[model samples]
Target: MLNGLGVWDIFLTLTTLTRGYLIWKVVNLLTRSTTGSTNVYQEICGQWVQTNTLTMDNADWGTFVRYAHRVKSIVIHNDSLFGNCKTIDVSILRALSMPPIPPASILFPQLRQLVCYDRRDEIYPFVRLLFGPKLTKVDVRLEASRSAQLAVLPSLAAWCPSVKKAELRVWRERPLGAGGINEVRALSDVVCKWRHLEQLSCGVGCLDDKAILHLGKLNSLRSLQLRISSHLTYHSVRQAEHGPLFQFLDHIHMVAIDSLSSCTSFFPLFSSLPPNITISPYAPYRSEGLCDLFTDLSVHESSGVLEDVSVEDHFQSTAPEEVFTIETLRPLLGLHRLRILSLETFYSFSLDDNALKEIGSAFPLLAELSLTADRGSNRHSKISVNGLITLLGLCPHLTSLSLTIDATRVDDIEPERRPGGGISNLNIDTLRLNDSKINHPRIVAAILFDVLPYVDVFAWEWGAHFDESDAEIYRPRWVEVQALLGAFRTVQEWRQPGFLPM
Candidate 1:
């Protein structure tokens, strides 16, 4: 038997090569035979981490380089790396830069898209390793100061010059003092180089007055979504002298706007915006502010060409002064091409029977109308059940409807006699009613049975909408209404010409 230094020599020589060969074989099987397909999309998570440069330091990287060649997308989504967290998707990229990999031996040479997420903003510094000339899309979310998030932009433009789509969100922004302004400047500079950037989503803080002005001039930008901050109000934008703003824009979104002032400040800047627009604000808006917003739209070149315009989240405020009156929404009535109009708020609209009739006549082609108010929002005179029926009859094209109706006086309001049921909302498929103050259940159900006889789905807010007392009293009435609808529907089916007893 061999002894002494011969045994130790074998251990030193064989053990090093054995460890490297074992790691290499495991990685090969994962990307090759294990999946039973060679074309599988690879991710940098557990098992994947073992092939990272740190694990294979000074060993062998031929197997890794072979696998990394086919990777077109790289995703780093890890929650907390400090614990023994099972999801290790966030670790590989951060460790890919050390040792044996070498500085210039680029991995992921064919990478085109990079999606990375970190709660602490640590993974992105190593994200550059995944960037290549062919990269077209980058979506990153990190938690850090505004300046730190802006720093990633410079690297993106440096590596992925022709990126067509970019979504960058920076959460938990700390106080930046004067440094914040410089970060905005940096964002403007970096994006100006993104000659092919067609769609962009970022925080409003990243696009100040000057930055937005430059962005509008980008001919390639078609869709833009700005996540607005309540604290930031854009008031300094002006018409660019060299060219028209957002000339070729097809879609525009202004989301998370906490104030009406924010909407007015930004919407008026563009000479003409996209026909289909989405403005979702988290806070309540006064009637006057909304009126001003629509008035601004009325003058824009896009208003005449507009079809669907939805201002979400901002609803009728509980305060009497904040309610949307017919006059407040008068500007929208002129948009003849408008098909879908949604203005659901927390409270109630001040529009009455006359207003609904006018709206129906104005937009006769309307298909979807959502004017639903929150529960217990009876501060104003709501449209009666008959008023809703008239509006539905006028707009035969209506398919989906969500609104608040007063069915309290369903019996006395209309005593007209009918045959089997009320006029059928034939084309209507979806219906949502914010039931309030309904003393008579049978009459209301009978009336609804006549109107909406063939609804595909009926949306009703139950326990979530009421207090214990409200639920106990009002729930049974609504339940009775639903049961009556079913009974009435059964009779209608029997009345059909080809009905069989079975």
Candidate 2:
């Protein structure tokens, strides 16, 4: 209970940057520890979910007011907390229309960061109260109508003067042209006030030719995410006045760009690239479009420094894009520093042993590679078990691997029997095989043990997309391979006393 909160604990909470939090999460959005549930959705975090609403009686409020000066961060959910709040102190309801609410009355006066969800009109009063003078960061998700959303933008700018990092997620507030132009202009006005903003996320509508040049001038911006409007086209960003656009950026994520041309044009507007990039389009592009996009990406000055690239879609479209063909992907061959390359689509790669070796040799430091495609045949790729051996030999640092391999024949010159002998990759811990043909389970299992002795995540198709015939043919064999891997793990653990568990 809040009754036990003391000035000493408050001191520690502010000094150590830990204890001052509402609900469960602290300052970090996703900590990725045992308490984090973001990476694995099924992970249960019941203990952390103590209460969404911070309740207080008259005595509790009195005690809370004592240590309020030390509270540094707060996270709130609008579903039941701030929007429908009924138990908060009445001092919050009185919104004084001044720049900084006098220190004598500011609620959580020392609060520096706020993460809140907005759904209704009830959040407006709490925003006035919660937006402390020292707030430097704000992450808001607004799911209200367009009119209601526009009404709150001006208030945020007037209140949160010190905010350096902001994320505004507008969810279905209004249609693109349905009286949204004015709201978009208001957002741009609010954004211009944040001159020192190191990170920002909002709709692409806030960035026009002028705003792009303005944002480019701020060298502190390192990360950016823009949710493209459905009405966006290549022409929308064509008029961007070409200056230093996001040259200091280290990470960028472009989400919901549906068309092929729109995504391509978006890249060239920024001549420099962030080391980490993610392009998530609602629809898949054709092979030529992918080639063109890569061409645009390759012309940049920092292309060699690019470390991670993920081009993914929710579902495989019946587009004409050729999957991972050597000819089509030649533009990306110069990204020698690439460590993570994940291309997820429900199609096969046009990869043979030679293409595979060439690609692997190009990215020598690749640590995690995922080309996990769910398709019917291995005809597009001729990389049998031996080919995998060659690929693994090339990529010595690959730890997590997902590929569509032709595992039909299990013939490999045993590492002991090769000309100079072969060395199996011991770095791989997660192995996910695409829907490739597997005729021999025992041999394949042994081959896998030889290739990736430490593979803990053995992934095969377990989705509802399979037909009865396909399931009957492939499921049991892979299941046997899994069983064998378990037995092999048991035997290996007995031999090597310090290996990580599978």
What digit string (tens of lDDT, one per residue) describes model 1 on residues 1-502? 1222232343343233223211111111123333344433223223222333234444435445644555677655543532432233334334444436564556676777787655444455566667778888888775446455557677778878879998766554342222256655666676777878799887443567666776788889888887565455555566345567787787787865456666666665666777778787656666787788888887776678778888776433434435677898899999988888987665457667788988898898899998865545444646777778889877888988877666685644546665123556777756776545467888888777677777632334631333457556765777777778778888888999999858
Task: Note the residue pairs that clash in candidate 1.
Answer: 315-345, 316-345, 422-450
C-alpha TM-score for every candidate = 0.74, 0.76
Residue lDDT tens for model 2, 1-502: 1334433354444332221132223332122324344332111111122233333344444444555555567665543555433232222222211223233677677778887664555555566667766888888766535566567777778777778899876666332333256655666667766777888887433444445556666788888877553354436345644566778888887765466556566676676878998776656667777677778787776688799988776544565434658776788888889998887755557777787888789999988888765554355767777777777888898988887677776555454564213457788777787666688888888777876777753535643332457567876888888889889989877778677655
lDDT of 1 at 139: 82
Per-candidate Cα RMSD to the true structure, in Å, reads 8.7, 7.8
Q: What is the lDDT of candidate 1?
A: 0.64
Per-residue lDDT value at 79 in model 1? 38
RMSD in Å for candidate 1, one decimal? Answer: 8.7
Q: For each candidate, what is the lDDT?
A: 0.64, 0.64
